[model samples]
Target: MTLYETIFTRRSVRQYDQVQLEASVLAEIRQAIDNEKQLPGQNARFEIVNADRLKGVAAPHAILAYSAGTDAALANIGYTLQGVDLHLQNSGYGSLWMGMGKPIEQSADYRILLAFGKTSAPLRAGQGDFKRKSATEISNEDNAIARVARLAPSAVNFQPWKLDFSPGKVVVRPDGGGIRKLLTGNLQKIDLGIILKCVELALEREGKAVTALTPKGGGKTFAVEVAFE
Candidate 1:
Protein backbone atom coordinates (compact mmCIF):
# COMPACT_ATOMS: atom_id res chain seq x y z
CA MET A 1 0.00 0.00 0.00
CA THR A 2 1.03 3.62 -0.50
CA LEU A 3 1.89 5.72 2.55
CA TYR A 4 -1.48 7.51 2.23
CA GLU A 5 -3.29 4.20 2.11
CA THR A 6 -1.24 2.88 5.03
CA ILE A 7 -2.59 5.64 7.28
CA PHE A 8 -5.91 3.87 7.70
CA THR A 9 -4.38 0.53 8.64
CA ARG A 10 -1.24 1.57 10.54
CA ARG A 11 -0.99 0.43 14.14
CA SER A 12 1.41 1.23 16.97
CA VAL A 13 3.22 -2.05 16.82
CA ARG A 14 4.93 -3.13 20.06
CA GLN A 15 5.64 -6.83 19.50
CA TYR A 16 8.60 -7.54 17.24
CA ASP A 17 10.35 -10.62 15.83
CA GLN A 18 13.57 -9.53 17.68
CA VAL A 19 15.63 -10.39 14.61
CA GLN A 20 17.57 -7.54 13.05
CA LEU A 21 16.93 -6.52 9.46
CA GLU A 22 19.45 -6.97 6.65
CA ALA A 23 22.05 -4.25 6.13
CA SER A 24 20.61 -3.37 2.73
CA VAL A 25 17.08 -2.84 4.06
CA LEU A 26 18.37 -0.73 6.94
CA ALA A 27 20.34 1.35 4.48
CA GLU A 28 17.23 1.92 2.36
CA ILE A 29 15.28 3.22 5.36
CA ARG A 30 18.08 5.55 6.31
CA GLN A 31 18.29 6.98 2.80
CA ALA A 32 14.54 7.50 2.69
CA ILE A 33 14.66 9.46 5.94
CA ASP A 34 17.58 11.48 4.64
CA ASN A 35 15.52 12.40 1.54
CA GLU A 36 12.15 13.22 3.11
CA LYS A 37 11.28 16.94 2.89
CA GLN A 38 10.69 18.81 6.09
CA LEU A 39 8.08 21.56 6.63
CA PRO A 40 9.45 24.16 4.22
CA GLY A 41 12.47 25.62 6.09
CA GLN A 42 12.73 23.52 9.25
CA ASN A 43 15.82 21.34 9.67
CA ALA A 44 15.59 18.30 11.96
CA ARG A 45 18.18 15.56 12.30
CA PHE A 46 17.56 11.79 12.38
CA GLU A 47 19.87 8.89 13.26
CA ILE A 48 19.04 5.25 12.50
CA VAL A 49 20.71 3.02 15.06
CA ASN A 50 20.54 -0.53 16.37
CA ALA A 51 18.52 -1.35 19.47
CA ASP A 52 21.70 -1.42 21.56
CA ARG A 53 21.87 2.40 21.44
CA LEU A 54 18.29 2.86 22.62
CA LYS A 55 16.59 2.63 25.99
CA GLY A 56 12.93 1.73 26.83
CA VAL A 57 11.95 0.31 23.40
CA ALA A 58 12.31 -3.38 22.54
CA ALA A 59 12.43 -3.06 18.76
CA PRO A 60 15.71 -4.19 17.13
CA HIS A 61 16.08 -0.90 15.27
CA ALA A 62 15.04 2.71 15.83
CA ILE A 63 15.20 6.23 14.43
CA LEU A 64 16.48 8.75 16.95
CA ALA A 65 15.23 12.28 16.14
CA TYR A 66 17.05 15.41 17.24
CA SER A 67 16.05 19.05 16.92
CA ALA A 68 15.76 22.36 18.69
CA GLY A 69 13.09 22.25 21.40
CA THR A 70 10.98 25.05 19.88
CA ASP A 71 7.36 24.39 18.87
CA ALA A 72 8.07 24.56 15.13
CA ALA A 73 11.17 22.41 15.48
CA LEU A 74 9.34 19.75 17.49
CA ALA A 75 6.39 19.82 15.08
CA ASN A 76 8.77 19.56 12.16
CA ILE A 77 10.23 16.39 13.67
CA GLY A 78 6.77 14.92 14.16
CA TYR A 79 5.63 15.80 10.62
CA THR A 80 8.77 14.26 9.21
CA LEU A 81 8.84 11.03 11.24
CA GLN A 82 5.14 10.30 10.86
CA GLY A 83 5.73 9.85 7.13
CA VAL A 84 8.57 7.47 7.94
CA ASP A 85 6.23 5.64 10.31
CA LEU A 86 3.69 5.10 7.53
CA HIS A 87 6.32 4.07 5.01
CA LEU A 88 7.86 1.49 7.34
CA GLN A 89 4.45 -0.03 8.12
CA ASN A 90 3.54 -0.01 4.44
CA SER A 91 6.72 -1.92 3.68
CA GLY A 92 5.63 -4.73 6.06
CA TYR A 93 7.68 -3.52 9.05
CA GLY A 94 6.45 -2.47 12.49
CA SER A 95 7.01 1.04 13.88
CA LEU A 96 6.07 2.87 17.04
CA TRP A 97 6.51 6.45 18.32
CA MET A 98 8.31 6.26 21.64
CA GLY A 99 8.49 9.47 23.66
CA MET A 100 10.28 7.81 26.58
CA GLY A 101 12.80 5.99 24.43
CA LYS A 102 16.11 7.78 23.94
CA PRO A 103 19.63 7.17 22.78
CA ILE A 104 21.72 5.66 25.59
CA GLU A 105 24.27 8.44 25.06
CA GLN A 106 21.67 11.13 24.75
CA SER A 107 22.39 14.70 23.80
CA ALA A 108 20.32 17.80 24.52
CA ASP A 109 19.18 17.87 20.87
CA TYR A 110 17.40 14.48 21.12
CA ARG A 111 13.65 15.04 20.76
CA ILE A 112 11.90 11.71 20.20
CA LEU A 113 12.30 8.12 19.00
CA LEU A 114 10.65 5.89 16.39
CA ALA A 115 11.11 2.18 17.09
CA PHE A 116 10.95 -0.12 14.07
CA GLY A 117 11.99 -3.66 13.23
CA LYS A 118 10.78 -6.95 11.71
CA THR A 119 7.52 -8.03 13.30
CA SER A 120 4.69 -10.50 13.11
CA ALA A 121 2.24 -7.89 14.31
CA PRO A 122 -0.47 -7.10 11.76
CA LEU A 123 -1.90 -3.94 10.23
CA ARG A 124 -5.58 -3.16 10.44
CA ALA A 125 -7.77 -4.49 7.67
CA GLY A 126 -9.33 -1.06 6.95
CA GLN A 127 -10.65 2.20 8.33
CA GLY A 128 -13.16 0.53 10.65
CA ASP A 129 -10.24 -1.14 12.39
CA PHE A 130 -9.15 2.29 13.70
CA LYS A 131 -10.56 3.80 16.87
CA ARG A 132 -10.65 7.60 16.46
CA LYS A 133 -12.94 10.58 16.77
CA SER A 134 -15.97 10.85 14.53
CA ALA A 135 -16.02 13.36 11.64
CA THR A 136 -18.26 15.71 13.59
CA GLU A 137 -15.92 15.67 16.53
CA ILE A 138 -12.67 16.65 14.82
CA SER A 139 -13.56 18.51 11.63
CA ASN A 140 -15.66 21.40 10.41
CA GLU A 141 -16.25 19.83 7.02
CA ASP A 142 -17.28 16.26 6.25
CA ASN A 143 -14.91 15.59 3.35
CA ALA A 144 -12.36 13.05 2.19
CA ILE A 145 -9.30 14.95 3.38
CA ALA A 146 -10.64 15.40 6.87
CA ARG A 147 -11.85 11.81 6.98
CA VAL A 148 -8.46 10.32 6.21
CA ALA A 149 -6.50 12.99 8.04
CA ARG A 150 -8.39 12.46 11.28
CA LEU A 151 -7.05 8.91 11.22
CA ALA A 152 -3.62 10.30 12.04
CA PRO A 153 -2.49 9.00 15.42
CA SER A 154 -1.96 11.27 18.42
CA ALA A 155 -0.32 11.12 21.82
CA VAL A 156 -2.51 9.02 24.16
CA ASN A 157 -4.99 8.88 21.23
CA PHE A 158 -6.27 12.28 22.32
CA GLN A 159 -6.88 13.50 18.71
CA PRO A 160 -6.62 17.09 19.93
CA TRP A 161 -7.03 19.03 16.66
CA LYS A 162 -9.67 20.82 14.62
CA LEU A 163 -9.70 20.65 10.83
CA ASP A 164 -11.33 23.52 8.96
CA PHE A 165 -11.54 23.14 5.21
CA SER A 166 -11.89 26.01 2.78
CA PRO A 167 -11.23 26.35 -0.92
CA GLY A 168 -7.55 25.81 -1.72
CA LYS A 169 -6.54 25.44 1.90
CA VAL A 170 -6.96 23.50 5.14
CA VAL A 171 -6.41 25.07 8.53
CA VAL A 172 -5.24 22.66 11.25
CA ARG A 173 -5.52 24.26 14.61
CA PRO A 174 -4.81 22.95 18.09
CA ASP A 175 -8.26 22.02 19.38
CA GLY A 176 -8.28 23.79 22.71
CA GLY A 177 -12.00 24.35 22.79
CA GLY A 178 -14.51 22.44 24.95
CA ILE A 179 -13.46 19.22 26.72
CA ARG A 180 -11.43 17.80 23.81
CA LYS A 181 -8.30 19.77 24.70
CA LEU A 182 -6.29 16.76 25.80
CA LEU A 183 -3.03 17.47 23.96
CA THR A 184 -0.60 19.55 26.00
CA GLY A 185 3.04 20.68 26.22
CA ASN A 186 5.68 19.90 23.57
CA LEU A 187 3.94 16.69 22.56
CA GLN A 188 0.84 18.55 21.35
CA LYS A 189 2.87 20.61 18.90
CA ILE A 190 4.37 17.40 17.57
CA ASP A 191 0.92 15.84 17.31
CA LEU A 192 -0.31 18.80 15.25
CA GLY A 193 2.59 18.26 12.84
CA ILE A 194 1.79 14.55 12.62
CA ILE A 195 -1.73 15.26 11.39
CA LEU A 196 -0.50 17.94 9.00
CA LYS A 197 1.45 15.31 7.07
CA CYS A 198 -1.71 13.28 6.65
CA VAL A 199 -3.55 16.39 5.50
CA GLU A 200 -0.85 17.10 2.94
CA LEU A 201 -0.97 13.54 1.64
CA ALA A 202 -4.73 13.69 1.35
CA LEU A 203 -4.51 16.93 -0.60
CA GLU A 204 -1.94 15.49 -2.97
CA ARG A 205 -4.05 12.37 -3.50
CA GLU A 206 -6.81 14.68 -4.63
CA GLY A 207 -4.48 16.20 -7.24
CA LYS A 208 -4.05 19.38 -5.24
CA ALA A 209 -0.55 20.73 -5.50
CA VAL A 210 0.40 21.90 -2.04
CA THR A 211 2.06 25.28 -2.44
CA ALA A 212 2.99 25.87 1.16
CA LEU A 213 2.72 24.80 4.80
CA THR A 214 2.71 27.94 6.95
CA PRO A 215 2.79 27.46 10.70
CA LYS A 216 1.07 30.29 12.56
CA GLY A 217 1.06 31.43 16.21
CA GLY A 218 2.77 29.67 19.11
CA GLY A 219 2.08 27.79 22.33
CA LYS A 220 -1.71 27.63 23.02
CA THR A 221 -2.42 29.42 19.75
CA PHE A 222 -0.43 27.01 17.57
CA ALA A 223 -1.85 26.13 14.14
CA VAL A 224 -0.67 25.15 10.65
CA GLU A 225 -2.06 26.53 7.41
CA VAL A 226 -1.74 24.14 4.46
CA ALA A 227 -2.09 26.05 1.20
CA PHE A 228 -2.79 24.23 -2.02
CA GLU A 229 -3.94 24.86 -5.57
Candidate 2:
Protein backbone atom coordinates (compact mmCIF):
# COMPACT_ATOMS: atom_id res chain seq x y z
CA MET A 1 0.00 0.00 0.00
CA THR A 2 1.09 3.58 -0.56
CA LEU A 3 2.00 5.64 2.48
CA TYR A 4 -1.01 7.84 1.92
CA GLU A 5 -3.21 4.78 1.66
CA THR A 6 -1.63 3.35 4.78
CA ILE A 7 -2.83 6.40 6.70
CA PHE A 8 -6.38 5.27 6.12
CA THR A 9 -5.70 1.61 6.98
CA ARG A 10 -3.12 1.74 9.77
CA ARG A 11 -3.93 0.40 13.22
CA SER A 12 -2.03 0.36 16.49
CA VAL A 13 -0.77 -3.19 16.70
CA ARG A 14 0.12 -4.40 20.19
CA GLN A 15 0.62 -8.11 19.61
CA TYR A 16 3.52 -9.13 17.39
CA ASP A 17 4.85 -12.45 16.10
CA GLN A 18 7.72 -13.79 18.22
CA VAL A 19 10.40 -13.66 15.58
CA GLN A 20 13.25 -11.32 14.75
CA LEU A 21 12.84 -8.99 11.79
CA GLU A 22 14.81 -9.92 8.70
CA ALA A 23 17.99 -7.93 8.10
CA SER A 24 16.66 -6.60 4.80
CA VAL A 25 13.46 -5.28 6.39
CA LEU A 26 15.39 -3.80 9.31
CA ALA A 27 17.73 -2.06 6.88
CA GLU A 28 14.78 -0.53 5.04
CA ILE A 29 13.38 0.81 8.30
CA ARG A 30 16.77 2.25 9.21
CA GLN A 31 17.05 3.88 5.81
CA ALA A 32 13.60 5.38 6.19
CA ILE A 33 14.69 6.89 9.53
CA ASP A 34 17.95 8.19 8.11
CA ASN A 35 16.30 9.73 5.07
CA GLU A 36 13.53 11.38 7.09
CA LYS A 37 14.18 15.01 8.02
CA GLN A 38 13.64 15.90 11.61
CA LEU A 39 10.93 18.38 12.48
CA PRO A 40 12.16 21.93 11.87
CA GLY A 41 14.25 23.24 14.80
CA GLN A 42 13.90 20.04 16.82
CA ASN A 43 16.85 17.85 17.86
CA ALA A 44 15.19 14.45 17.97
CA ARG A 45 17.10 11.19 17.50
CA PHE A 46 15.89 7.76 16.32
CA GLU A 47 17.34 4.28 16.74
CA ILE A 48 16.24 0.67 16.21
CA VAL A 49 16.81 -1.59 19.15
CA ASN A 50 15.93 -5.07 20.35
CA ALA A 51 12.66 -5.52 22.17
CA ASP A 52 14.69 -6.45 25.26
CA ARG A 53 15.83 -2.83 25.46
CA LEU A 54 12.27 -1.77 26.09
CA LYS A 55 10.12 -2.61 29.10
CA GLY A 56 6.60 -4.10 28.94
CA VAL A 57 6.46 -4.16 25.12
CA ALA A 58 6.32 -7.57 23.47
CA ALA A 59 7.23 -6.64 19.91
CA PRO A 60 10.41 -8.18 18.56
CA HIS A 61 11.75 -4.80 17.44
CA ALA A 62 11.49 -1.33 18.95
CA ILE A 63 12.48 2.00 17.57
CA LEU A 64 13.70 4.10 20.48
CA ALA A 65 13.06 7.79 19.85
CA TYR A 66 15.25 10.24 21.74
CA SER A 67 15.25 13.99 21.96
CA ALA A 68 16.58 16.80 24.10
CA GLY A 69 14.15 17.95 26.80
CA THR A 70 13.11 21.02 24.87
CA ASP A 71 9.52 22.18 24.82
CA ALA A 72 8.79 20.98 21.28
CA ALA A 73 10.87 17.80 21.47
CA LEU A 74 8.17 15.28 22.24
CA ALA A 75 5.77 16.66 19.68
CA ASN A 76 8.53 16.82 17.10
CA ILE A 77 9.39 13.19 17.67
CA GLY A 78 5.76 12.29 17.26
CA TYR A 79 5.59 14.16 13.97
CA THR A 80 8.85 12.76 12.65
CA LEU A 81 8.59 9.12 13.69
CA GLN A 82 5.00 8.86 12.56
CA GLY A 83 6.28 8.83 8.98
CA VAL A 84 8.25 5.72 9.75
CA ASP A 85 5.19 4.28 11.45
CA LEU A 86 3.18 4.71 8.27
CA HIS A 87 6.06 3.46 6.12
CA LEU A 88 6.30 0.29 8.18
CA GLN A 89 2.61 -0.33 7.89
CA ASN A 90 2.80 0.19 4.14
CA SER A 91 5.63 -2.34 4.06
CA GLY A 92 3.40 -4.91 5.80
CA TYR A 93 4.83 -4.57 9.29
CA GLY A 94 2.89 -3.70 12.41
CA SER A 95 3.63 -0.60 14.51
CA LEU A 96 2.46 0.96 17.75
CA TRP A 97 3.26 4.37 19.23
CA MET A 98 4.65 3.47 22.61
CA GLY A 99 3.87 6.51 24.71
CA MET A 100 4.05 4.67 28.01
CA GLY A 101 6.75 2.07 27.35
CA LYS A 102 10.00 2.44 29.31
CA PRO A 103 13.43 2.13 27.73
CA ILE A 104 16.12 0.02 29.31
CA GLU A 105 18.78 2.53 28.33
CA GLN A 106 17.94 5.19 30.87
CA SER A 107 18.59 8.64 29.51
CA ALA A 108 16.89 11.92 30.18
CA ASP A 109 16.67 12.38 26.42
CA TYR A 110 14.68 9.21 25.71
CA ARG A 111 11.25 10.61 24.89
CA ILE A 112 9.12 7.82 23.40
CA LEU A 113 9.18 4.39 21.76
CA LEU A 114 7.54 2.80 18.71
CA ALA A 115 7.15 -0.96 18.98
CA PHE A 116 7.00 -2.57 15.54
CA GLY A 117 7.43 -5.97 13.87
CA LYS A 118 5.44 -8.80 12.32
CA THR A 119 1.96 -9.05 13.78
CA SER A 120 -1.33 -10.88 13.60
CA ALA A 121 -3.44 -7.75 13.77
CA PRO A 122 -5.17 -6.58 10.63
CA LEU A 123 -5.09 -3.19 9.00
CA ARG A 124 -8.43 -1.53 8.48
CA ALA A 125 -10.03 -1.81 5.02
CA GLY A 126 -10.37 1.93 4.56
CA GLN A 127 -11.06 5.29 6.23
CA GLY A 128 -14.56 4.07 6.99
CA ASP A 129 -12.92 1.49 9.25
CA PHE A 130 -11.61 4.18 11.62
CA LYS A 131 -13.49 5.24 14.72
CA ARG A 132 -12.54 8.89 14.50
CA LYS A 133 -14.11 12.25 15.25
CA SER A 134 -16.06 13.72 12.38
CA ALA A 135 -14.38 16.42 10.25
CA THR A 136 -16.89 19.02 11.37
CA GLU A 137 -15.96 18.34 14.96
CA ILE A 138 -12.21 18.72 14.44
CA SER A 139 -12.10 21.77 12.20
CA ASN A 140 -13.92 24.92 11.12
CA GLU A 141 -15.06 23.28 7.89
CA ASP A 142 -15.31 19.63 6.87
CA ASN A 143 -12.73 19.97 4.11
CA ALA A 144 -10.12 17.51 2.90
CA ILE A 145 -7.51 18.57 5.44
CA ALA A 146 -9.89 18.31 8.36
CA ARG A 147 -11.15 14.95 7.11
CA VAL A 148 -7.67 13.41 7.11
CA ALA A 149 -6.55 15.14 10.29
CA ARG A 150 -9.54 13.61 11.99
CA LEU A 151 -7.85 10.23 11.51
CA ALA A 152 -4.76 11.21 13.44
CA PRO A 153 -4.25 9.02 16.49
CA SER A 154 -3.91 10.74 19.83
CA ALA A 155 -3.19 9.89 23.42
CA VAL A 156 -6.22 8.01 24.77
CA ASN A 157 -7.90 8.94 21.42
CA PHE A 158 -8.84 12.29 23.00
CA GLN A 159 -8.50 14.04 19.57
CA PRO A 160 -7.42 17.09 21.56
CA TRP A 161 -7.14 19.65 18.80
CA LYS A 162 -9.30 22.08 16.83
CA LEU A 163 -8.38 23.52 13.42
CA ASP A 164 -9.37 27.08 12.59
CA PHE A 165 -9.01 28.40 9.06
CA SER A 166 -8.14 31.93 7.99
CA PRO A 167 -7.41 33.49 4.62
CA GLY A 168 -3.91 32.02 4.32
CA LYS A 169 -3.46 30.21 7.57
CA VAL A 170 -4.55 27.11 9.47
CA VAL A 171 -4.39 27.47 13.22
CA VAL A 172 -4.29 24.33 15.39
CA ARG A 173 -5.12 24.54 19.08
CA PRO A 174 -5.66 22.29 22.08
CA ASP A 175 -9.32 21.55 22.82
CA GLY A 176 -10.98 21.18 26.24
CA GLY A 177 -10.05 21.97 29.83
CA GLY A 178 -10.06 20.75 33.46
CA ILE A 179 -9.16 17.08 34.00
CA ARG A 180 -8.80 16.34 30.28
CA LYS A 181 -6.32 19.21 29.98
CA LEU A 182 -4.32 17.99 32.94
CA LEU A 183 -4.49 14.42 31.72
CA THR A 184 -3.03 15.20 28.28
CA GLY A 185 -0.99 18.36 28.81
CA ASN A 186 2.23 17.19 27.16
CA LEU A 187 0.68 14.40 25.17
CA GLN A 188 -1.75 16.75 23.44
CA LYS A 189 1.19 18.68 22.04
CA ILE A 190 2.49 15.45 20.58
CA ASP A 191 -1.03 14.80 19.38
CA LEU A 192 -1.00 18.16 17.60
CA GLY A 193 2.14 17.18 15.76
CA ILE A 194 0.49 13.98 14.60
CA ILE A 195 -2.46 15.96 13.33
CA LEU A 196 -0.15 18.43 11.62
CA LYS A 197 1.50 15.60 9.74
CA CYS A 198 -1.88 14.45 8.54
CA VAL A 199 -2.62 18.01 7.40
CA GLU A 200 0.71 18.21 5.59
CA LEU A 201 0.11 14.93 3.81
CA ALA A 202 -3.42 15.89 2.82
CA LEU A 203 -2.28 19.25 1.50
CA GLU A 204 0.65 17.70 -0.33
CA ARG A 205 -1.70 15.39 -2.16
CA GLU A 206 -3.43 18.59 -3.39
CA GLY A 207 -0.13 20.34 -4.34
CA LYS A 208 0.10 22.66 -1.33
CA ALA A 209 2.94 23.21 1.09
CA VAL A 210 3.12 24.72 4.54
CA THR A 211 4.57 28.18 4.00
CA ALA A 212 5.49 28.59 7.65
CA LEU A 213 5.04 27.14 11.11
CA THR A 214 5.25 29.68 13.93
CA PRO A 215 4.85 28.99 17.58
CA LYS A 216 2.16 31.24 18.95
CA GLY A 217 3.11 32.71 22.31
CA GLY A 218 0.51 31.20 24.62
CA GLY A 219 2.76 28.81 26.51
CA LYS A 220 2.39 25.06 25.83
CA THR A 221 -1.34 24.92 25.10
CA PHE A 222 -1.47 26.59 21.69
CA ALA A 223 1.69 25.07 20.27
CA VAL A 224 1.77 26.28 16.63
CA GLU A 225 0.18 28.21 13.82
CA VAL A 226 0.68 26.93 10.26
CA ALA A 227 0.53 29.06 7.13
CA PHE A 228 0.05 27.55 3.69
CA GLU A 229 1.01 29.30 0.52
Best by TM-score: 1
Model 1 over residues 105-132: C-alpha lDDT tens digits? 9599998889999988889999988889
Q: Judged by lDDT, which candidate is best?
A: 1
Q: lDDT score, residue 141, model 2?
A: 86
lDDT of 2: 0.81
* Model 2 agreement with the true structure over 136-199: per-residue lDDT tens digits: 9989988888888789888888888899987778888778567877886767777777787777
Please list the residue runs of candidate 1 whose C-alpha ends up more than 4 Å from where it truly belongs after superposition: 176-184
- Once superposed on the true structure, which residue ranges of model 2 sit more than 4 Å away at CA? 218-221
